[model samples]
Target chain A: MISPREILETINMISNENLDIRTVTLGISLRDCVHPDIEIASRQVYEKITRIACDLVKTGEEIERDFGIPIINKRIAVTPISIIGESSRGDMAQIALAMDRAAAELGVNFIGGYGALVHKGYTEGDRRLILSIPEVLARTKHVCASVNIATTKAGINMDAVAQMGFIIKQTAELTAESSSIGCAKLVVFANAPEDNPFMAGAFHGIGEPECVINVGVSGPGVVHSALKKLSPEADFSQVAELIKKTAFKITRMGQLVANEASRRLGIPFGVVDLSLAPTPVIGDSVAHILEQMGLEKCGTHGTTAALALLNDAVKKGGIMASSHVGGLSGAFIPVSEDAGMIDAVRCGALSLDKLEAMTCVCSVGLDMIPVPGDTSEHTISAIIADEAAIGVTNNKTTAVRIIPVQGKKAGDPVEFGGLLGGGVVMPVSNYSSSIFAQRGGRIPAPIHSLRN
Target chain B: MRAVITVIGTDKIGIIAGVSTILAEAGVNILDITQTTMQELFTMIMLVDISKAVVSFEHLSGRLSAKGDEMGLKIKIQHEDIFKSMHEI
Candidate 1:
């Protein structure tokens, strides 16, 4: 029989690899809280979100303390305001403001679903919600927006895609004085999954129950440690097996946490997103995992293949362990948050071009990347457009979270510290795409546009 | 007669393309193929019609096993109806 301490050590080894419960997102549907009267709807929205999400942070914290592991983010995702606002006679902006106030009052870091899901066709309310995003996000502190433009079964929604391309540009323009970073809080997706607990794409869909609890798990450090233990002479196949076993163990922990948390919270447990979500920690870098795999640096010739293997292994392990696995469950390469990634940029081992290529195989795109302060808004919009195109074309979820640090040059370090990580501002090629970004109409959906 | 070929074991180079080429050369028409790799483990399902082929199921399995030895892939050929019944649940 295995000794309990040894089993515990194995558990610790698995948990320590970038593995921790990623997010314990409480989904609260605000549709029932709506009223024909604007003030009543706003008040109801506030009361419902606050009531349902009341124990979210405390419960997550208690679980972390009991389990002796970290729960990185405690968040809330509400039903898409576009859907709720449709039944209300009040202004959609008022609903957004109320939602923002509720999130702040509840002390949650971010509240998702301040946008629309117009994959095939847009409703009047969705159009309003789309147009109101720039104002809603700019005026509010922590409201994140997302728009689903396509899905595999439904094909691609070109009209929504085109509108979103323009909306991103407009949102950037509206927030340009503040580094045009509001667009960073938005995501465009193809098959936008229902139970994704991560943001800024998380939203409570109409198909979901009244309330539920979902957890996202991360463990890049654990995977890296496993890879590090392998002999330097080990070939790629060995490396792949190690990653799969590590991911299997890590995902098992996630399933446990999700089940325990859901049981404690008295709500149905949602999926465990087996994403390698990184923090601002020194040892917990996905880039470091690649380096440990014998790459002189990340963002090189073998990067895509490496990412593909990691992504596939993670999904396979997680899917086998739980029927509830969902969310963006793959390796993440957020630039600013991972130390090895920061160093890679500082040493020129990584670049925007390589980052884009890697995103095709990873979970998210261009996340937390810091560009030069002086980079043009049009250029930022262009980058968002490019990333969105990849997600739409390939039928995956991708997002951009770029920060243009004020007065920061390309090589200078900006320390957001804590979970945001520190990073050297990366240089975007000086080439300007202002004219194209400024054209601002949606790129019509691909000919395969099917989802309505 | 229709047949279902199940490939299992480690994923290496040229599993599907190699097996498909042999089936094609034998005048087998593939109807559907699904494959997934988990770490070193690989699983594949191929639905094909071998009624026009010049060989029996045992003969085809024998040939595939020989090729499987060469490529380190395990290939099992079964009747399509039997496979469907076994897998329906």
Candidate 2:
């Protein structure tokens, strides 16, 4: 029989490697709270969310204290307000206000689903929600917004995508005086998974149970450690096996923790996202994973292949261990969160070009990347457009969380601390994509699209 | 009777061609086949109809087993309906 300590050690081995439950998202469906009286509806929405999510922070804290594993963010995702309030003419901003207030009172860091799912066409509610994002994010401190404009089965919603380009530009312009911070909280997605525990793109699907606890487990450091053990003479096949085994062990631990947490909390267990989430720590970097795979550094030759292997292995191991595995359960190469990645940018070993190439196989795109302070709004829109294109073409979800550090140039660091790590602003190629971005038309869905 | 054959083992060359060849030789018509290669592990699922086959289910299983041995594959054959009922839940 296994001792308690042994079991604990096995489940918590990577805790010291900066491993944590990245987010514990409580998904609340608000479709039933709709009422003709907007005020009554808003009140009902607020009460429902508050009542259901009241235990979220407390439970997360308890789990953190008892298990000694940090639950970094306690978040809530409601049904897409647009669909929930389809009949309401001008209640989106009011509802968003109620959500913001509830999040503050409940002490959750972020609340998602302030946007729409307009992959095929836009409804009046969706358009209003899209228009209200600038105000919503500007006025609310904890709200995050996302729009799904494409899916493998439904093709791309070019009209919605085109409108988003304008909306994002407006959002950035309206909030530019405040550091254009609102754009950082918004994501545009394609093929978005329903059970992702991370933000700013988590929402309760209509099909989910009344409530569930989804855990996103991450440990770039653990994979890095395993790679450090490999001899220089090892071939690509050996390296692939090592990553597979390491991912298998890590995902097993996630399974155990998810089960234990669900049993303790009395909530139905959700998927365990086996993403190789990175941090600002030195050893806990996806770039280090590439370096370990015999690349001189990340952004070198064979980087994409190495990342593809690691990503595939992680999915395979996680799927075998849990039937409920979901989310972006692959390697994350967020720039500012990983020290090695930041260093690579500083040393010119990584560039936006290479980062874009890497995002094709990564779970997230252009994440936590810093651009020059003077980067134009059109340029920013262009960056998002490019990432969105990749996601649509590949039938994967991608997002950009870029921070335009004010008054910072290449090699200047902005420190957000904690999970949002410090990183230097990298130079954006001076060459302009503004003309293409300014055209402001939707790139039509691919011909093979079939998603509903 | 319809049957499903799941082939799982270390992947080598000609696993699909070998298995399909055996089924074809037995006068079995395959309805569907899906194979995925994950590193060294090769997994395949084949749905076939055996009611019109020239041989019995046991004989087909035996012949497939013999072919698997020749090809170093691990093969498991079951009635398609049985497999679906067991898994569809």
Candidate 3:
């Protein structure tokens, strides 16, 4: 029998500490759904997603009821639409609507992979998908779009970066009535994970199985609670130790839930994404964990070192608990979705520059940040370029999901509501980068990428 | 299959009797139980075997939870695997 203490601890963590499975994402490959005729291809995409992910939400709920774990989201990640729509010569938005319909019919919240990958350069399909993102995202509620413009081997596609800047501004303009919410559904990535269960960046990779189940587990509150028990004199190593032990327990729960979900759905279990994803709820912020590590605030001087330690220890502890660990398996520092981060930003303790520095050690870069309405397209591109450079140079995944909320400036708030929680717009540098962005070409792959 | 049921609230008479009654009616045999008091709050942990349970796990859980609500207690029934997997490995 499991010890009574352990049982009580698990219950307390769930009820009080917000320990829950963040997502049970079913990865469905849509490669076979390609057709030259746009309407037929769209139908095929819709049929396949609905057929494969029909039981996802129901099964997730059933597991939640039995295990008493709150599975927050049941989502679907399809093959990057660029590849699937390559041969089709029709409106890409039609296919995006198909995905939206499938998500609605299956009762899933988010259906990702309305994406284009132009790491080196764009093909006709990639160009079409990328160009259609602004309209596609504004029209579809559940569909998400990601564009991967850089990789270690391929370097950065400055052309795509330049294009995405315009697309993001257009997306914000199109969805301006709803707090410029379209930008929240779009992510630009360098080395985006194919098996990521979290969105708006998850996509079923080409190399993945035809159908599989991936789980992302998060518990910032659990980690925070664990650290509270540590003595003030606890060294950095002790802080690391406590974080590892807490993360191990969290990931073990993730592994169990992943295996159970896979078994129930009759899909191959892919991986457990060991990430400390936070919510807007109090006590569940990654920033609070940093503050608990002795920083007066999250974005202060020691913030990067604290985040680095937290990220490394989480990965180290989680790796051993699961059979497979993949995706963006570290702490996520999304500004809007975290209460502590929002406070940090609101109080001026956190800034875009410091956030960028912190992302070097964390999972993703510049996530869920809302900038001024008048922030230029060229500036957004320049920001994306910087993040891409970091990813390419360091050989780690980095992404930008910045929302340029129309009519909202710094000190004003944009209320996205739900899991896409509201946040105040943070000020961006007023410098112009139009000339730098207009220099269009690929930044050549690094020397380290030539190791083959 | 086994599950862990935890009952937490202010100390009250019939807390054990009420919880056990639901399990008995559902044909869930209680394997072990431990109760403790911390300050003014009471906590009871029960290990139960539901292999021969007449009701579904969800059904049994809902019934116990509804009973808890009536008695002003917080009751949670979770599969035992969650605790074992987290604590053991």
Q: Give the number of the best model, judged by TM-score.
A: 3
DockQ score for model 1 = 0.01
Tens-place lDDT digits, model 2, residues B1-89:
67667676787888888888888888899988777653466767777787788876667788787888887876756554322221222
Off by over 4 Å in 2: A3-12, A169-179, A405-412, A429-435, A438-442, A450-452, B1-89
For every prediction, compared with the true complex, DockQ reads 0.01, 0.01, 0.82
lDDT-best of 1 and 2? 1
Q: What is the lDDT of candidate 3?
A: 0.93
Candidate 1 ranges with C-alpha deviation above 4 Å: A8-11, A14-18, A87-91, A150-184, A373-378, A404-409, A429-452, B1-89
Best prediction by lDDT: 3
Q: Write the per-residue lDDT of candidate 1 for residues B1-89, one digit (tens) a residue.
A: 67667676787788888998889777888988777654456777777788899765556777887888888877766554322221222
Error of 1 at A153 (Å): 5.7
Report the C-alpha lDDT of model 2 over A19-70, residue by residue, as the tens digit: 5667777788898888767787788889999998887788777656433456
User: Candidate 3, residue A451: CA error in Å?
Assistant: 1.9
- The C-alpha stretches of model 3 lying farther than 4 A from their native spots are none
Worst 10 residues of 2 chain A by lDDT: A1-10
In the range A226-286, model 1's lDDT, one tens digit per residue, is 7888999998888888887777766766776687678888989877888888776766888
* Every candidate's TM-score, chain A alone: 0.88, 0.90, 0.99
